[model samples]
Target: MNYEFTTVGALIGLAVAIILIIKKLQPAYSLILGALIGGIIGSGSLVTTVNTMVSGGEGMISSVLRIMTSGILAGTLIKTGAAEKIAEVIVEKLGEKRALAAISLATMIICAVGVFIDISVITVAPIALAIGKKSGYHKEALLLAMIGGGKAGNIISPNPNTIAVSEAFKVDLTSLMMKNFIPAICAVVVTILLSTMLSKKQGVQVTENDLEQKEDKNLPSFIQAVAGPVVVVILLALRPVASIVIDPLIALPVGGVVCALACGQIKNIREYAEFGLGKVVGVSVLLIGTGTIAGIIKASALQYDVVHILKMANMPAFLLAPIAGILMAGATASTTAGATIGAQTFAGTLIKSGVSALSAGAMVHAGATVIDSLPHGSFFHATGGAAGLEIKERMKLIPYEMCVGLTSTVVAVMTYVI
Candidate 1:
């Protein structure tokens, strides 16, 4: 493919995909369609485009499998009331005076342990709302606290975005996570500060109507509730901590099983697994679709153009990874897709430019946090719905979320690039 044609096609395809996403088309369909259009335009043949898409989607199989397996742990935590128990303990300890900080920290811990950010927000929303009612904090403030904390934890998490970047850079997942730890902490601090400030600004108060009545059930003991995540963390850490290698695919399901056993939910494992699988099916498809677009971009001249432009401007080579990450995530309104596509397209150039794989992966992973909560993405609506926020109220939280993400991105640059 000619450089000019490929570059033009790639740019046009990305624009179309972003536009379609803004139009409320499903991201998976939009990305796939965009990939087909870009591939055909760039290669000038239908067969070539189809072949490239298949090849691209093939590259995401490992990531897809890891993400799918992660659902088991997520389902076990959410369905068995373990996640809520974890949140309740933290909030109780912190008390109502520290409600914002408590909710933020709880959500951060839950997400860092591997729950999806959206699910984390949903899981913690009720608690946050109840706290808001007692503390006289606005519902929007509580929601922002959870959203910000989730984003912070997400960067260092064993979640899909982290998995995608680690695989793309061929680095140990734990190493990538460790590299992101400081940045994640910085993000959390920012979340707490901003949320506290927002809490004091005076807004609509949480009322009884906003709260859901709880169903009585036998909740797990704290020890049992903590067991599952502890097992997964220990297993994952064993690679770096004890020189015992275990893939996440094995570790995640094992954690789920341990969690169920500890909680005495062994009889319902099949139901939990099914629920987990259902939650991840859409996400799995989204990753595959992102892979196709990434493949198209890789085969085009867009990357070279970006590098040449950066060089002409005398920017550091390491800047490309984060820049690509932020732009793609902003375009897609999804951190996982943005981080995956950015790493897939730029990891090679980043490595060749003298950046280490771990550094490159960390930079991109943090960058994806920026602008990932835009309204076009499901995170915006799902979380807003869970918090019962109006569209306008949700919109007000975007800048705070961006600030949290930017703080993490800056820390990543300092830790890795400087």
Candidate 2:
């Protein structure tokens, strides 16, 4: 076990990226610049750095763009008033009884349909706002409910992160799903409970004037509106089934198109698609930047260094995956990266410690999701845009996720104990 620190240059580049982000520099620029600096230190050639960054960006964006069709579906839901109708129906069903639970339930279900949390927020926030205005509840609490619910699904879901992890671990999708599905249900229940507790403890301010106004947009009947997003989610949930695999890349567009035509949005379908594309711009930029960073880190000595430390560290087998995942994902502001890269980096050490691949994968899933929405993260920006709130403005939601993320670890551990 060769235990050596990461190169000083790699460390410095990371610090610079964080400092720039702290100063409110765009994450795309921060990550790109950080990658360049790290490359210069590791490769010592400008041409080599550019080549690596370009290659890395190309690879990452292929995945990002493939998934971005979901963003279009999400945006259409918001613009067509489908999303608002969905929220209204859910709230109506709950009827001012356990309002928090209603918001949370809606959030979890909407977000579980394999869309990014950023897409989830941008799509659902209008309805959440509408729901909030109809009730006497604090808009902030409602907003947090929207975010927390998506997060629960995001952590262990039909989302891209789960797919990404499944690919990374090489576990049969069904086996992995069976291992995680029950814990995921528990996580959502806990999410609603925690959301209620924190909402009561804090006084949060919200600008809800827009939410209070009547929506004049032409909309579908509530049942018709529900069908589109629901189908999208159901298709995604079936991905692991051996007899059938629903490709979200295909499902989202199909679902989005059906909803657009069904909901009287065809007249402005182009506009809605454009709006959805625009929402993903920042997210795409960030993914490209993260690609560069991931590339630089992999191209350098850091990979070996990370594995060495994991091998030598005095940590319990059950705790290592989540801790490693949290740190990596927090740094990159990407749940996929944290789970994928961190798991692979530590794979050998974990197997050597008598941990099953499936158990380790479960831990990886839990760990990566905890701190995934730092300011640089796509979810932070998208939610900010939809909620009409800034990063600093909605930070009260972060602690709740941190707590939820910790519970994910407990879920992972229970898989072992049971």
Candidate 3:
């Protein structure tokens, strides 16, 4: 309702916020306070600013809930030794030479089937560690490779972003999936190869790990270990086949239950789920804070100015598509947020301007993914946690992400341009 806000002030607020975040303020605090500062500079009153923050945080509870459930599933996999068994089999089958790439590819396969990175990474992490012990791969390279694959799946798969596009554009899910399938394949492959290369180039040293290289053949069978996540994937995919809705919140837990039953960890399943819940607070708060910031900006003069700038840029469809994705994703630290917001704001504009939905989708998917790997993001934090590295140690992770983002964007541009 305030009209007195200046564009320059809002921009200044955002810049200052980024500086503060880089200075290592808590992420939740940084993002929430940054949005508030921006809102105030944009001529919003303290009252309206507080309301927007509350509304934004409240709006994200459902998403946060899903993330928690995913955390629970991830924790269960870790605790059960189920994740270890699967990783062992994959690495053993691929042997020492190809083991690094195999871990990345395996995670990609799981994600391709519909699992979220938040869920897949925790489970796959054990695999990466297993591989590192089995073969002397650089811990950092393995981390980058695993993230690249999971990030690819997150960007390319039929999760929230594509689903949002389908609903908003009135396109069928099948149609959207068909359109994105090839791009997803190409992106996943490129993500694995390029991430590994870039990480190695970034001076990832393969120091000897001190992990016990235990052969757990007597542990749960690989098939049994994989049953939970595999079942979740199948249930998610069968949405159209069964013509019934399947929520990850429902499916993942069911699979978790099965995994617990199989691994015989049923007694502490609740405890395991609780442990998972604790791990995601960092990401969950940041996600909610992003929503809050987004709400405040929407309430400010920022949205109008952004829309006008978008109109004035007049860039090509391929360029603008990824640009749109990058902007939202960089600010929000979420590919789904970036993709959905970009689609809501620009996908229609592109479509109406004669760009094909398939091309537009690829560009958006790739573009949003480019910046979703920012150091402050949930994925970055998750990767660090998975690798048991300090924040400073995790710095090597960025170059690989930057490379993958660049590669995917180039591929999308080429796809659309050609």
lDDT of each: 0.90, 0.66, 0.65
Per-candidate TM-scores read 0.98, 0.80, 0.77
User: For residues 1-418, could you state the per-residue lDDT of candidate 2 as single tens digits?
Assistant: 3421245556566667767766778877887898788778664478877787786577565446545775677667767777666766776798665777787766766666445666666666766666555555564576677777776667544454555455545554435545766666676677778767766664444445656465476667887677677676566556665447766567776777777887867788788878877766666666667667655655566655555566589545656667767877787677765665556445555666787878877777778878877876656676766777656766867887777777766787777867
Clashing pairs in 1: none
Q: How much is the lDDT of residue 201 in candidate 1?
A: 85
Tens digit of lDDT per residue, candidate 1, span 1-418? 3432388888788888999999999999899999888877775488777787788899999999999999999889888888888988999999998889899999998998888999999999999998888778998799989998999889878899999999999999988988999999999999999998998786767889999896886889888988999999999999999999999999998898898999999899889989988988888999999998998888789888898999999998899988989999999999999999999988988898899999999999999999998998999999999988889889999999999999999999999846
lDDT of 3 at 412: 70
lDDT of 3 by residue, 89-202 (tens): 766788767766777766765555445665567667766776665565566777777777776666555455555445445554544555555555666677667655754554
Error of 3 at 215 (Å): 8.0
Colliding pairs, model 2: none
Candidate 1 to truth, TM: 0.98
Highest lDDT scorer: 1
- Residue 409 of model 2 has an lDDT of 64
Give the per-residue Cα lDDT of candidate 1 at 403: 96
